[model samples]
Target: MINSNDYKIGRIMVGASDDDVRYVHEADNLPYYHIGSVNGISMVTIDVIGHEITHALVKKTAGLIYQYESGALNESIADIMGTMLERYMLPNNWNWTLGEDAVTIRDMRTPEIYSQPSRFEGPGWESPGNCPFPFLGNDYCWVHTNSGVMNKWFHLVSTGGTFNGQNVNAIGPHAAQQIVYWALANYLQSQSTYSDARWSTMAAARDIYGECSNEHRAVIAAWNAVNVISPVCPGSGGRIAAEQIENSAESIMKVYPNPATDFVTIQLFDPITTVDLQLYDMTGKVIKAWNTKESTITFATKGLVPGIYTLKAQTPKGIYTHKVIINQ
Candidate 1:
């Protein structure tokens, strides 16, 4: 659960003429949930209410843009929370299908039943390339459909499962929810991708249960099951490597003091004439920029908030990115 005072639902309008129920922010800038009717039948159910309300929570917290991967993530979070709420309220009648009371829309246990992709870019996956505009595209780049990937991941984390050749040990619903909520509130940024979510949730589990704990391992396994490989955590006997390019082995970039409290050093194995360097926060905001010919640069992390940041370098060969964490 999160701070309710900051994101209180403004109103719940029942019997609206809208085709479907949804959460929206109008001119007042307050969140409102509208329950629509179909042929004089109200579509107000416990899961429906929970789903819409979660949209409000997500908007206030992560503020994920309602398009592409971020939009899919938003939809997935709503579904996951809605299902969890339904289970908590009606344990006897709990089911994985969304809108079971009104209509069977999405199934978290098996999303392919409704033409949703359970695996990333797998069967039933919607391509964003074809849908350029949200208004014209396939449900805003198939947000509802693509959400199945993350939904399945949540299901696996809550209840142990083996998928994509990876086996995960269940962390249970309560622990899974805590890790997810913590990641959304503390680490996730507006433009976060699936890879970012993987990193954020792993970091959250580490913060809550310690590095390489069972819960943290469960998070990693669940992500790997969904085919989203996260950057290796620090002190796990491996360093976070940059994206590889053609002949990238010739120019190796090394970043030290990954979990840094005061400073970090960047050293390039192969010296180049000039390099353009930029540091960015998780929100995709550039924190620092430098254009220098030096191969080794020491950057100060003093006064910076402790969190995940990215260091990017543009050399003659290719662009490289390194993930860094600042510790207070």
Candidate 2:
């Protein structure tokens, strides 16, 4: 039994009478992973195990909703982490193929081989319009299928590649994993889309490697290779600002007592009747939330760990963000 403060995995059942392996979160709030056997062969490989465990990590952190683009991102994260784990365990024999020891479902280096698209809207891409119901069609808006785009992006980022007229310089697997993991943990949200992912990963690379660095450039090129273009150009130092609306003269939102130990307050310049507020940790996990009509709101932060956090407000105009710091 593996246990942690965040979550616990109660069981790992192998040789189940099932066609596919899966990770399940039961009503008791515990996680369980099952490995199935086919033709007397078990699908209990390291990559497969890593894939399922990464699902639990996603739930604990980003909690990305399993539908549409977010769903595809969920699957892609699992695949990326799985491949990284495989490489870590078997450094001498590691390859980009997932489940090579078992079913051989996905090949990150060559996603097209498994009928998955390498670039957005490229051949073999599955459109969400084809599936009216989430349950009836190809893996919930092609979550598994569209994940190939990101898988390909990761592959290119890890080991230099040229695709879709874009060439990405290899950053190697360690740096690539750090940037992607940082983005997943610190920037992404539950309802975040692929565009959001592009921005977040770029921001993560900037945070880690500085602006205009080779690693940052590689991240941009990789995303472009997968056709998930970011509105912000390289070396410009602007990121997804087109999606946000702000006044030139004054800020729309204000957060006070930034490096506070006890409490923090938020005030809006032009208050709407209803605004949604969310506080996220450095790990992108929601800490506190509010839906209120008041322009100024204050909340306690007594028990939170001292770190930098993100405060986001959703208003009628647009979404606004504020950086907060806590010190104990």
Structural similarity to truth (TM-score) of each candidate:
0.69, 0.74
RMSD score of candidate 1 (Å): 7.6
lDDT of each: 0.78, 0.79
Clashing pairs in 1: none
Q: Per-residue error at 235 for model 1, in Å?
A: 11
Instruction: Pick the TM-score winner.
Output: 2
| Candidate 2 similarity to native, TM-score | 0.74
Measured with C-alpha atoms, the lDDT of residue 176 in candidate 2 is 87
Task: Tell me how candidate 2 scores on lDDT.
Answer: 0.79
Write down the worst ten-residue block by lDDT for model 2. Answer: 241-250
True-vs-predicted CA distance for residue 16, candidate 2, Å: 5.1
**Runs with alpha carbons beyond 4 Å of true place in candidate 2:** 4-7, 38-40, 231-328
Tens digits of per-residue lDDT, candidate 2, 260-316, equal 889898876777558788887755678999988787888888899987676777777
